[model samples]
Target chain A: MSVSVSANEVADAPQEARERTILGLTADAWLRILMPLAIGVIALGGWEWAVRANGVPSYILPGPIEVGQTLVRDWHTLSISLWITLQITFAALFVAALLGLALAVLFAQSRVIELSLFPYAVILQVTPVVAIAPLIIIWVDDIRIALLICAWIVAFFPILSNTTLGLNSADHNLQDLFRLYRASRWQVLMRLRLPTAMPYFLGGLRISGGLALIGAIVAEFVAGTGGRASGLAYRILESGYNLQIPRMFAALVLISLTGIAIFLAMTLVSHLALRHWHESAMKERR
Target chain B: MLAGVKAGPPVVTLDGVVKRYANGTLAVQGVDMAIGQGDFVSLLGPSGCGKSTVLRMVAGLIAPTAGRIGMAAGGEATGDVGFVFQEPTLMPWSNTLKNVMLPLRLAGMNRGEAADRAAAALAEVGLKGFEKAYPRALSGGMKMRVSIARALVTKPRLLLMDEPFAALDEITRHRLNNDLLTLWQAERFTAIFVTHSVFESVYLSRRIVVMAARPGRVVEDIEVNAAYPRGEVFRTSAEYAAHCREVSDALHRAMGE
Candidate 1:
């Protein structure tokens, strides 16, 4: 037994430890990089060709090129508005994450609480943010605070629902061990349940990121938060009202870019935190 | 004091301990047994014989439906009850040392000193160098070793193991069996192991309590005169084979196989 164990020790050394490295570059890699660019170029070229061929004025169906030019022209105005939108989106998301996790823990601890409150959460989720946003504006005197609350209501439920499920999903056996150790409820929660809930929480976070952006955009429409603390939504609405079709297209382009950027940022953060071996993060490495 | 009185003057006793699930399936019944301090015992039976349930009952992880359980002077927190599960059950996120340190950490020991004791416990289980590795990174046997380390890390007066070797390969099992015997000798912990293998039970235990299923109860108690620090030679000896056969026959008879 001693000899065998010694041999295992010898074998245990990290000799050719079989790293999970991707071996060779394939057409897939190039496909990933070029496919989007190709699609974007093709779509924009088609739009340009259609607008020019039809002899449509810029006010009606302006080309992507015209929007880009408008974007360049209105960079300073767009930047301030983008910054405001970004701030509200992030702040609401932060509050939503904290509240979501807290509510999850609360729900996980008591079946009675979970059963009683889960329906209300579902209702909040299904209720249109557009409907609630105006109500929030009417109730709250401060426009900034009201918009934040509206964004929060829109974005918070997904996070709360998903994270509650995550916290409840801890391994039964591990929980038994913790109980046997006479670990305090807090210790068990922090040391075992929270870490176990991480991947799920991150999953919720990814989903909620897009929801947060949508919430901010939707809230802006309802808040009519213009002239002061105006966002990309206000820019789009202003351009639409003024019949600056090219500028409206430009604002639309900016909004889309922000959404894409938020999605990528979230994906990157998830990858960095859980990329070690989590299944969700494996897509990019492959 | 009341627990001691209810237990009726035994170091450890299970009186008519029956466990019935909500669906009315009885896991254990009328299991009366007593263990003195410094005894090495094994609950030997076929799978689903409720042997694991018995161990869990003793460990206070599961309550027996119809039994009076009594622990010795130290009480429930005896601070001496250590349980090693069938699966390693090491927290996947924790490294080997941290996994072993779990109980001590739970006991409110300072982190630095707890790590120190945890390191020594790991060394005692022959897992000296793999302290930094996570349970996911370790082999099955290595993970089991970490469990053993965690079990012994507290220097518990009693150790409860449920089929600790069932998941390992034979080579690893044999090594763990030897290592376990050595640990028992050095620590002198009152060890109660649950196993389906009569050979394994006969090999390590001083007394083997054979159990039968479908309302599990101990039907036989066989004494093994195996000496301390039992090594490989004992495993291959005539005495060892005789003990194995007796326990195996008893188990077969208990199972009605």
Candidate 2:
């Protein structure tokens, strides 16, 4: 009887396993998507109900439907502003990545240089971008360049510090092995130190993405530059002076959405890069 | 007296080697030994005995404060030495094949040749189909096997292992020990193994150098007259037991010193 039961189990195992996985995945995946979506719907419904029930004016508190209508009505202007903001954000992030990586490598190569210069990086990070934007605009002459500088400053330090730590954190035993093989400095940096620093660099990049967006928005706010080439932040400022509350809220929604989109893109890039090797990106498997 | 069945000319010679750290700690003192070509020697001692320091000095990872360590012509050049740490010490970012191919790539070997050699080395260590597996995906023993494969990928003349299997479970440790010995026999590389386990020292080495701590120095060197390809039967043999007893006694004596 035991032998026959065992045989039956072996025969039924594959189909049973396949059925279980399909059902399991569907349940799990649905919960993950539905939970957040349900919360969002409830919150929006409450907001819409409260606005109507209280008879709040559109200027003071637009309902969710009014906000959505404003977003669609102002799509052309808002999108152009969004494009400008996105351009600055991504440009700042790109420059920050390049400069941060270069500076970190420089720091890795020499202790004396790091000791002399690293305090300045800290100073730049701690000093608020808003505090410096006006002076930067005055000194740089170009408003766009000034805004770019501000965003770059905000996004630079994380990458530099994280990559430096990662480069220095290469396994000591591996360093010894490299030395035993008499590897050159170039080989050590490229083959060992750089690979070790990759996850750390990606981590910093994710943080800097959001920061770059905030920096751009803040710098533009301080710049107060109006018309033609104005970012979403300018749209908010312009709408405030004109009492366009619904348009202002619409701009806020776009900014928040952009920030979320940038974060998701960074996460996807990190997952793709490290899915094969890193603990952070790996999925559980038998 | 140091005695061993010398296999060939001495591949590595250490004469009165001393290592004093920058903080003025006398890590090792007056250590003298010669490892013959294709010989397996274990530096057995408790912690703080500087056995690892001595191994590092031999591998040229660190210079001795007051002694001379000479390697034979074929053993002194770049890529002629391989060192394994107590931990697997693999690059977490790379797959097994890439990790094993590192030395060859560092030495400027072409991609195709390096890949073939790395794959062969992986196969030699029983990791043939795991070339693409990352270190995080592997079990401890499998990771250690990849490390061993990486070490031997260059076919180094001298292999320095500092307690390579000390962190493993007893069963895994024993299996790795057997596999390591098989590799040594097939590769014909001189090995300097560091360990604190008496049974491990007795089972793996042709000669065991028992060391003492606090101004770390060798107290006794005993030779094992057992034959090659020692397996489970040899491990359970009376001869192996006797050798283990002798080494354990020497270790105790060294500790007491």
Best-fitting candidate, measured by lDDT? 2
What local lDDT does model 2 show for residue B104? 93
In candidate 2, what are the lDDT values of residues B1-257, reduced to their tens digit? 12334568899998999999999999999999888888999999989999999998988889999989998887767778888888988888888899999989989999999999999888888777778977776767778888888888998888889999887778778878888887887788889999989999889999889999998999998999998778899899999999998988888899893
Q: lDDT score, residue A250, model 1?
A: 80
Tens-digit lDDT track for model 1 on B144-210? 8888889888888889998888977787788888888778767767888988887888888888999
lDDT at position A255, candidate 2 = 99
Which residue segments of model 1 deviate by more than 4 Å?
A: A1-31, A45-56, A275-286, B1-10
TM-score of each: 0.90, 0.93
Candidate 2 regions with alpha-carbon error over 4 angstroms: A1-29, A284-286, B1-5
User: Every model's DockQ, to 2 decimals?
Assistant: 0.29, 0.28
For residues A1-286, could you state the per-residue lDDT of candidate 1 as single tens digits? Answer: 1222445633543332333433454566666778999998998899899999999999878988888999999988988888888888888888999999999999888899999998998898898989888888899998778878877887788788778877877788788888888888899889988877878888888788888888888899877666845998898889888999988888788888888898888888878876543556554431
**Candidate 2 residue pairs in clash (backbone atoms < 3 Å):** none
| lDDT of every model, 2 decimals | 0.81, 0.88
C-alpha lDDT of residue B256 in model 2: 90
